[model samples]
Target chain A: MSGVSENRVLAGSPSTGEAARGGLIADVPRRALILLGLFAALLLVAPATVGDYLLSVMILVLYYAYLGLAWNVMMGFAGQFSLGHALYIGLGGYTAGALFVHYGLPPWFGMVVGAAVAAVMGGVIGALGFRFGVKGVYFALLTIAFAEFTRILFDHWGWVGASSGLYLPVEYRDTDDLWLLRGSATMFYYVILAMTAGAFILCHWLLQRRVGYYWQAIREDQEAAQTLGIDVFRYKMIAVMLSAAMTAIGGVFYAFYYNNLYPETIFSMHRSIELMLGVIIGGIGTLFGPILGAIVLTTLGEMLTGLTEDLGLDGIKQMSYGVALLVIIVYRPGGLWPWLRRRLGLEKPR
Target chain B: MPIDFLLNILVAGLLTGLVYGLMALGLSAIFGVMKVVNFAHGDMMVVAMYATYTLYTAAGLEPVAALPLVAAGLFVFGFALQRGLVNRFINATEHMQFLLLLGVAMVITNGTLMVFGPDARNVQLDYAFDSYNVGPLIVDKVRVIAAGVAGGTALLLAAFFRFTVTGKAIRACADNFTGAQVVGLHVNHLYAVTFGIGAACVGVAGTLLLLITDVHPHLSTDYTLLGFIIVILGGLGSLGGALLGGVLVGLSEALSGALIAPSLKSMFSFGLLILVLLLRPQGLLGKQA
Candidate 1:
């Protein structure tokens, strides 16, 4: 019964949504594959060409891109705005880091548990919000409340080092330890690059599947989808849970990469906002949009820093970021990806 | 807990809540009229505080003395903001609106930091340590003055909205956007006026706040969240509700701080916000959706 409805939804929407997808599927698969191969090859050898500082910047860009992809699953695809997504990142990072720090467990083992925990957290938020018929901004507020409440709880909970912070043992090794997940910056960079690629593929596959169609239908109109026999509560829950789980994996990487976690910084609203900025500025719900956004935003931010540093300005870089964001949002509400597609004559102009 | 000790906490909460009520009122007013959440609500208030600070440092003027001047400045600022930037996005999606205001918030915060740096700033007040003793209850003089001033502004705001022609016109617009347009109301001007009033209210609130607490650019986000929580608790559009909600939070925070760890006070406040949101989202005095 559900299968028939899923097919109906799939057949019904994307025939039109395909155009709105920023011309992702409009491209020939062969061209996309070639481009993907070239992009991946360049990233693989990027460490050799770029200096350590540039490599670090690239890592940040990719890291945020990974988070943006994870966040896009719930927000962009499903049309559920989560203002407190930092909660998932903090939870996953802390859970995995704590397990590794306290019990000497490998991060791979810890990440599984971390992802599960984040999924459950996401589920709880979904159940409470969706069941009560909270929609749009109200739902966003609910997420923020839960995230802040959790942050405060963690702030006082002595188990995770309370407000002081959680730190892991630093191992300066020349060789990469894949099992322990401790290694050089190059190793970490490769790991994150691989993760970013995986996230994009996973999103693409999900969009092709039945669930993705249901999500797009729901995002377009919840009531209409419900009238069509789609289970609204369940699909929304799945999106939230899956997104949370993926973000937690990023969290595990963040904990190991930073070697320390503070509830203050990790669970901050600023972090939540920063992660999604790329998605909004690039192309929302588009697979390659976040990657491009990450690259543009990070590079722009670096350039601004260079300009601001000579003048020794305290917050000018941030002000420029704010100004830049406004300009992009005002000029390209459909995001840079769709705009780029039009410029390259790959997609029709809106 | 001893009764006097409890009363002391209660008094403290009430004092803090009065100021919070005024701040939330500013946010609620803008939201009520425009139906758009001012994400930069708190940052604008912080800007008002800086205005007050400038008046103090440059001319040795008291915040009380500079209140009207700062509020007028904020009114102009808010008016320009709504007319220039926010007006373009009124018809846009909610996501775009949020992003736009978040951008505004970032610019305001960073710009303030660029000019003032990160250090906390304060004024040297003559009545800083003075207190009033009534029987067994002791209250700080500065807090009482701040609270009193905040309460007065809220009253003035309520009266303005209730009695003034422009205020009624704004309310009519809130009641029905298209009808107001059909009736030939200059909605854009009214919107700018409503936004200016909201900003001016925050100016009043921020000035009073500076009388009691120190000011910095980063404190604005906390205020923004606090305002939202209060407005939600009191009900979204109700002027009276915002005050009630503010008092509730203030009392709860005071109680939690005394009963639990001081750091966990915000946990209780957020907990109440969640409960209110989940259980009775219309808020204590809000109209049903």
Candidate 2:
């Protein structure tokens, strides 16, 4: 089946032993290490040098990169595709936003609740979905159903502003509120950058462990993984929980950064698709793929937006993205990262 | 629970549910043969609505009168889409199928938005807003006609699938692609025809929808999701199941909108879908594959 082989293509060249033998950093090729260092340096310095407008764009790129990495843990490594990831984002954002607005609680504390709620939601979905043996496209549809249900429920909820939408009051402050997570563009950029870095390191560490191998095995062939006594259900649940909770953190960051929440916008299928594009474009299972994808997609989208606006051609950007997705699926199914990996001789066939 | 009120809801649900059934029938048939979820289905419906609206506005034809032309146009478009774009990825991964469909959906919706703008347009006839009383219960005149048309289409589709050689071939292909190929069935042609028929069903629905409501670029996404729920509830690849599932969903939606909040109608359907998936993964009327 194509499902089995797509994961095989990802797990093909990289032998697990290399990544497991030390930390991810310890086993990295020297060139990749150098590139990682250079990239880190660039991220650290960009906020300082870039203008406010560009800083905002950088923040969005980092935000997507962070979300993509979290999602990659589930879809890429674990081979569980969730098409309704906006559930976590919407839940997490609403939880944190409601707390701040209603109770005057800071975002730091609110993020804990946000992540917890999302993890619980993930746990329920995984439990119900996996226990019943819903897999593949059916599983994806199940996730969409849950997200749409939640979105509709939230739209009718009064405490969260119903369909009118919830907006946090903008108290103009010159300085960044570090604890409260209220800040200017530069401050938010650094925060998102740190989050992206944290996610990368955490994912790298996780992928080097037994759980990562179990996930790959389960993803590749569930029956085979079960034959080897891999406890397939538990590992898949772990992936879901981990991915959901991490994405919730992104939701919290998004809430504070944007200072608004809407059931339609936050929980829309459009949001979920936008979140997954980076990983799909960059590379699904590769560690650095989401990062590269986030940068490439966000940059291209912004450029297209600017160009289309200048030319008075509305919706050209969205059409381009759709066309791009179709083209990529048809011609470049392995995505940019895998192609680059082969071209650079980073992953040679055994 | 006034008897008349409940009866009115039941009547309305059955009428609208017939439309939903026809829409889901097309979706189910497409999945039956192709094993691909057509995410662009709703967008195609919207396109049909726009086409019908254009015909009605330009030619001064009634909305319902423009149904055949729109259905033919969409059938050709669906046939071309399958023969050209989707055929290449028919054997690809399930993930690829979803991405391809989603991409097509995005392109169609955005392209329509670009061309038509975000404004909602509707074709209004004198009888559209009128209602009729049959004894104690009242029913909308437009809904009655829509229900009749949808039911007629479904019956015609069922008869075609049951009696025609092409329909048998399409079903055979759905049952087993390689087996059908070995049996000398042109699987590709059947696929194109099945997709075309599905799109044609949506065309009929789009035309009917223009009578009671408005059309916009994003109108079809709601229908798309509804179609998915109906298909799943009826059982994937089961035509009759989609019809029954659509009725069940339509009835629940109507009842909920009447008794509970109108906004929660879709939520109710989604909850039912999740419940069904958890309890009966094979669907209510669907046989286990």
Model 2: per-residue lDDT, tens digit, B29-69? 89887998898989998998888888888899887778888
Best by TM-score: 2
Worst 10 residues of 1 chain A by lDDT: A1-10
Complex DockQ per candidate: 0.58, 0.71
Q: How many backbone clashes does candidate 1 have?
A: 0
Q: Against the hidden reference, what TM-scores do the models get?
A: 0.95, 0.96
Docking category for candidate 1?
medium
The reply for model 2, stretches above 4 Å from the true place, is A1-21, A310-314, A348-350
**lDDT score at residue A111, model 2, on the 0-100 scale:** 89
lDDT for A31 in candidate 2 is 68
Best by lDDT: 2
| Model 2 complex DockQ against the native | 0.71
User: Mind giving the per-residue lDDT tens digits that candidate 2 earns over A52-83?
Assistant: 87888888899999999999999988989999
Deviation of model 1 at B42, angstroms: 1.1
TM-score of candidate 1 to 2 decimals: 0.95
